[model samples]
Target: MTVDPRAALDRLIASLEAHYNAVAGRQSEDDPAVDDAYDILADAFEVYDEALGTAHGEALPFYLAEEDDDEDDEDDEWGPEGDDSYGDGADVEDLAGEARSS
Candidate 1:
């Protein structure tokens, strides 16, 4: 099922407006209305991005950040002893030695 990019863009704009309204009229710090609006806005944005890419071979300049991972876990990939695995098979230590000798 293909979506019209223009329509998706309109929906995305409306969702943004709704989110702004929800935040502006917040009842409390933990307002469910704001949360719901944010969710809707996120969904609309994803749909619009997909539709725009599919229809015009172009994409938005930015992307929504994923919320799945814990902030502290970001550096786990580097590990306690940082291993440089440059996919091109360049030895980082050898490069550093060459730079120092130069």
Candidate 2:
């Protein structure tokens, strides 16, 4: 079946936005969760761009390139490594402790 890459990309983009909204409800844009979301979005676009580069008018499934697989496995799960929110274990509490010591 012939699939339109552009349509697929649009749908992916919409899904990402929805997921971001759900995960970041009531959080400031500067929140680390938001930053992680942007990084995820950027990574998604990079994958799409690479796929487009190799696609010859054919429907290519979007996937991360093996070469780009450099993130720690723990980081692959997304959302604070376990929590539903983002931070990478570097939340405001951690920052506050650092600031107090300095």
Give a tens-digit lDDT track for model 1, residues 1-102. Answer: 899999999999999999999999999999999999999999999999999999998999999977846534535443324455343444578668879999
Off by over 4 Å in 2: 1-11, 18-26, 57-102
Task: Flag clash pairs in model 1.
Answer: none
TM-scores, all models, native as reference? 0.69, 0.37
- Which residue pairs collide in model 2, if any? none
lDDT of each: 0.85, 0.60
- Best candidate according to lDDT: 1
Best by TM-score: 1
